[model samples]
Target: MKNINKNRLFIASCLALITTAMTFAIRARLETVFGPEGIGLTLEQIGYAFAPAFFGFTIAMIIGGPLVDLLGIKKITWMAFLTHAVGIVLTLLADSMTSLFIATLFIGIGNGFVEAALNPMVASMYPEQKTKMLNRFHVWFPGGIVIGAILGWLIMDVLGLSWQVMVGALFIPLVIYGVLFFGQKIPVTERVQLGISNQKMFSSVLKPLFLFMVACMFLTAASELGTTQRIESLLKESVAKPLLVLAFINGIMALGRLFAGQVVHKLSPSGMLLYSAIFTFIGLWLLTVTSGGMTFVAAAVFAVGVTFFWPTMLGFVAEYLPETGALGLSIMGGAGMFSVSIVLPVMGNLMDNASAAEALRTMSILPAILIVAFFGLHMYMKKRQKTFEV
Candidate 1:
């Protein structure tokens, strides 16, 4: 702690996450910009174009996770900055399906590297408060979405400016975080500090509990991110300002994450996931039925549901599977983003062939499975807690 700047490191992590969240918001706007009304790509094609972001994220995390242990966190972080810069420039010049798809791939990998570098860094920085600190660090995801969504709304919808203007906005953060992390010292990952071998780390993640969470990570990420990524297409038929609804949903989410410690303390991480799944399922059901201002209400419910899903999932692993270390955290994150990659195209196809409501109904099914799975997880944890206490 003496040689390190924890405050600066934490700030850089949040800013990096903010950059990642802004990409999501900007890309959501891009779907409509490049849709039938604008550049004429079909929603399904746009989904295919955007698919790289999630899967690319999965790829980066899978590779970067182990690399973070072998190399230091600082190298992966700078890799994020370079890729983010390239992605932004590419996005600005992009005019075709191939160009947009490639642009998103760089951004996706940059996003993945950001998560890869930061999650373990935070865990190492505050081992005592992994859940609370991780939640606090992740608050910027939705917070950045609100910033990016509103800015997109004002810049495009209100100012009537070009979409490239919004894409260009990412460079601002890309540079700032790069500067902050340039010379600062980063701690060794918790795994390295504990002297656990790579073989042991890899085997720990193969545990039945870790594998169970991996399966659930697929559903949770799809149920949360898959739905939001397509919010514009899903709700455009009903709401005049679907972006605002996106903003509203994330605004509530930002607030929920800002105060997640209290909720996590009371409910425990498994209980929190259970609660989120139920609310998300119910909220997605409401979005399929409700219209107009009521959409915000349904969205508010949805926001509250997904508020803790991502961070809590990471926290649960850090707390329970301490030996899995950076690699474990990366697998959880990689699994989540990978699931979103698979679902985005499916949701888009549903939007194209069927209806938004039908797609939403299909999404709600994921959390329904989660509700059952998490209930089992909660009970399993409860029994384990009692055994430990005795």
Candidate 2:
């Protein structure tokens, strides 16, 4: 390939990172507005509204992956910008659950599009450094959270600004990304650029290891994002400020992801997943039992546990299922977000009737679920590796 416009790529990546941070800032705080105390929606209802983001993300990926091949990345990136802009605007106006739901759907789709285009873009630009670069690229997920968290603290805590202002902040990055991609030429996806056929790509995605890895991705996304997004309502009784806890968890997560390559190389994905599950389980258990400052401490540990979960899932897919190309990357992201979308309501409902600790205990079932799933995944991959050698 010709020398990539490193400057343009960096600009595009920064746009993606800031936008991702913006998405989470809104998603993480959805409960603050729509929860029992805010807009007076039931926990179940809030989940229903939030479901659109994940569902829209899934829809975008399932549809956008091949479309990216057919339509090209430039069109899709612009679509993301437009949809994200509209979504944020609608959400700011929403007083009812229906409007909020639809708005979130739009934002979610936009966020998915960001993944659809940007992941492949980064991978394409840095072909030889897939895992390392991707990890560094994903630093934004946590890094953005740190930015959003600080913003949330400032807007909500310091200035007492409206949540609408927080939601509206997304537009700044949206406009910036739109402008960055305006005159630029987007290359074909990595799979296409490599001259791999669609059949080969599909076959790679269909392999047993790929499927197993996707399963792990689903659980990891659900376990990490699902649990963290619900922290506000889940720990209302234990912590004085739930948002601060959210910021703290994400702050540590940013630090961890920034340094993930060295750690992943040492521990390996499966090894990392195992330890992550253990820490998550312990952290949830601690949240259930502890109160006061210890709660924040446990939340931080939970954050550390989950730090590698999402990106590693993506990184593993890039390594093991490169054939799925951009399609696989998009699907993994969609699936992970969709899984978390499903969990949000269940968490909300548990919080509605039971105590926060009880809700946390119920959520604990997920990490336990991960332990069993990852163990099986580890063994299955081991067995599969033997066949290739034979």
Candidate 3:
């Protein structure tokens, strides 16, 4: 194999990071626009609007995963760029709930393709460092949230700029990433490169165990992001500035993901996941029961809990279900976002009728359910290995 271009790979990784951050930034702002007092949309309405991103992501992943193998990365990369551009343009024109929803759907689809194209691309480029590199690569998800949150504060809150200006900020990175991918030699999908048959990959992805994991991933993602994205509205009664709180939580998450290699090296993904759930439980409980800066602390703890959840889940699938290939990873990503899409509206409904505390308390059930699910997954994997050996 020819030597992998570290510089190009690094550039690609950065673009992926920026795209993730941009998506979340827009997500964060959506609550602001569609929240109770902003444009007079209810919590449920905001949640429904946000649903498009996850559903679009799921659509892209299920559709694009195989295409990445057949059509190659260059075509997928261009698709991501075009979809993102069109989505953002639609979002900027949004005036009502209907327009906002449509725009978000397009943007969500674009965001999903970004992951569908880039994740396996990165995994293939740095084959030897699958876990670490992927974790490091995923640093941008939380990292971008932090950037988005801070930008939210700077443009919308502190500088008193129009929210439209903040939405427009995404165009900068979209153009840059597009430029970076231009003329770049895209790497082969990991499954193809490993010489795995498409049938094997399909079977591995659709296996009962894998499907069960996908179910758990969806709930975990919904529980994690659905709650965090609403931190501003949920804590509006407590925090003087909700966006600042969002920034603080994401700051810790970004730092944690950047250092995830050290954490993963010390603990198995299952162990890390269990630990994450515990922290998430404690954090959510505290957020629900407390007030003031303590709420921020709770948010930080919750961030730490989920810090490893997204990338680690991918790493787990990659390590344990390698035959599932890019399709599996795509499904994992899609399922996660899809789960969030479903949960966002539920959270919105809860907040609409019940108190913010009630909504959070309701969301807490997700992690509790996952605690049991992870243990089951661990046992299943162990039993599978035993069966394989016999």
The best candidate in terms of lDDT:
1
Better of 2 and 3 by lDDT: 3
Q: What is the TM-score of each candidate against the true structure?
A: 0.99, 0.93, 0.95
lDDT by residue (tens digit), candidate 1, 1-390: 679999999999999999999999999999989999999999999999999999989999999999999998999998889888888999999998999999999999999999998999999999999999999999999998988899999999899999999888888888888888988989999999999998999899999999999999999999989999989999998799898998899999999889988987799899999999999999999999999989999999999999999999999999999999989999999999999999999999999999999999999999999999999999999999999999
lDDT tens per residue, model 2, 1-390:
464566776577667667866677666676877777788988889888888878898888777887787788888888888888888889888898999899989988888888888888777777776776777788787777767767777887799998878877777777777777778867788888878898887787788777777777777788778777676777778888877788788888878877887897787667777788888888888888888899888988788788888777777777767778998888888888888888888877777777778777877888888988877766766777789989
TM-score of 2: 0.93
| Model 1 C-alpha RMSD to native | 0.7
The per-residue C-alpha lDDT of model 3 at residue 141 equals 78
Residue-by-residue lDDT tens digits, candidate 3, 1-390 = 375565776676677567756677657766877676788887788888778888988998888888888898778778888988998899889988899888888887787788888888878877777777788888787777777888877888789998888888888878888877777667788898889998899889878868987987887788778877777778888778777777777778778888888997888777778788878878888888877878778888888888888888888888778888889989999999888888888877887788889988888888888888887766766677789999
Using TM-score as the yardstick, the better of models 2 and 3 is 3
Q: Candidate 2 — which residues are off by over 4 angstroms? A: 379-390
Clashes by residue pair, model 3: none
Model 2: colliding residue pairs: none
User: Which of 1 and 3 is ahead in TM-score?
Assistant: 1
